[model samples]
Target: MAGREATNPGDSAILVAERLTRVLPGEVPVTLVQDASVRIGRGEFVIIRGPSGSGKSSLLYLLGLLDRPTSGRLLLEGEDTGTFDEDRLATTRLAKLGFVFQFHFLLAEFTALDNVQMPMRRLGRLDEAAQRDRAAQLLRDLGLAGHEHKRPSQLSGGQRQRVAIARALANDPVLILADEPTGALDTKSSANVHDILHDLTRERGCSVVAVTHDMAFAQGADRLIELVDGRIVS
Candidate 1:
């Protein structure tokens, strides 16, 4: 497998799908994603937009390797993903991908710092002190320094979401997949989240592929892909 080129930030495609499709069992199998093909390069900010039942979320799941395609092939970092077993896929996801969803899935029982450190702890690469340090640093980087010790319930919606972002970065993933990450926040918080995503792509050179229904949000991405009826319409 070839690693993405380190030349122009957007020159190397980090994620690629060829004739990708997903089938769901019904009376007859229904193809939710139909012959979809997409290539998102490193540092690219790509938005997947669509109406309800248009398969936007389905497409995102495939890209994030959370769901397997029923047909065609997917390549991550130029490595064919079809051959990978579930364990290999899990490892790849842990090492290469980060995700932020519409809701902040922070553990309410834990403080923001503890929640952010969960991934590092699972990976077991850092000692206790090192994990704490990295978690605190990530929260600080996401502008949640003051909220580290606070529980999710004590923090504002925006702050909680920021903590989730920090948690996503805990593994330093090469790609971030966000499913309406700011959908639950106010306009201000949404903007803040948007800015953080953009900064990650532009500054840290991470590829960001977001699934959104907000036109305002989609317009800001480097590329906007429209999915309708399980296919790319634009």
Candidate 2:
């Protein structure tokens, strides 16, 4: 994979991980990520790719602040997150980061519009009407315009994923972390999701970091980080 590198991957980065590592304690402790360092710039589409158990998703979780690193540091938009408490971390995640998983994870019972509104409601940045407007616009932008009232079960696989993307964008996050976002879709649907995410960087000025096994998806990224046994490989 070939793509442009940031002129200054650190000073101007949207997300930076330095010597990040994660370990799970048990009878025999397991290390999921080891000494990883990387920087993602604004509007960059980055792909984290490796074989199974290479810690792709683990690294994403660490970057997204969903899990703490056993050691090392993460900086979001040049702010060090090492000292942030759980509540602060949650707040930061909700405000500055968005996530899309392989599973759409849309609430089956909720309409697509309601699902997108959930994040904005939690963030409380907008009133109910404003939230509804934004959610509707996001869905429309993702080609789900008239489908907003439909439940996840009523939509196609691709439409459901688009709804998931809209939900991820509800809070207007600067960094979007996607873990196997297209893993469950067919070829055409996968391409659609791929184009939407890649377009986000250029069109919306949002950074995207996706963990994927699909080389086709990674090929379109602005940068690629390959991992082997939890370590980034040159």
Candidate 3:
């Protein structure tokens, strides 16, 4: 999020972050995150909840590798990410992480299938035929079977979010980081998105760490990470 981005291998943990902190430089430095340590494991659903400006998004960004921490060590799959250069960080993000946001961020003119395949294309791990097949299957699994050819503009809000979820799952990353994935949806749609995200953990053995204000979703998480004033609290 606007604020600013651990995992380890073994015992199903995909990320292990130890005392991560991010500071925004200024005349008076602003600390967006402080001493935030967390572990996200395979097939685990973790929820991050905090008031606005409380560093919830900042912490998520740090965990997701979208932002570098000023200090602290983060290990992803047992590799120390603290030493990764910008190019390596970008490559790592593309290869090992997926993201979802309130806006979906789908290409305006591309079909749902194309959007889902974008990550696979960028990673170039599979040939075109395999990419298409995986993308189509992902959409279908996300309940967009007949709508693969439809563009984001043609789909409903719920459908668009489903497409985004499929796209997030495109690379089959170990962890999926989402910020307000249901922030723009109707009540029913919100519930659907929540359920879909929750199901990913059980069905796909994928870890999910979401920043949300929805208590219903938070309550169902395997763990709820609470943040206040840039610090984790009970």
For lDDT, the strongest prediction is: 2
> Among all windows of ten consecutive residues in candidate 2, which has the lowest summed lDDT?
1-10
Which residues of candidate 3, in runs, are more than 4 Å off? 1-11
TM-score of 1: 0.93
Separate clash counts for every candidate: 0, 0, 10
Off by over 4 Å in 1: 1-10
Q: How many Å off is the CA of 64 in candidate 2?
A: 0.6
Which candidate's TM-score is highest?
Answer: 2
Worst 10 residues of 3 by lDDT: 1-10
Ranking by TM-score: 2, 3, 1
Task: Write the candidate numbers in order of decreasing lDDT.
Answer: 2, 3, 1
For candidate 3, list the clashing residue pairs, or say none: 5-61, 5-62, 5-63, 6-15, 6-16, 7-14, 7-15, 7-16, 8-15, 8-16
Which sections of candidate 2 miss by over 4 Å?
A: 1-11
Error of 1 at 147 (Å): 0.9
lDDT of 2: 0.90
lDDT of 1 by residue, 129-183 (tens): 9999999999988888788899999999999989998988888899999999889
Give the clash total for candidate 2: 0
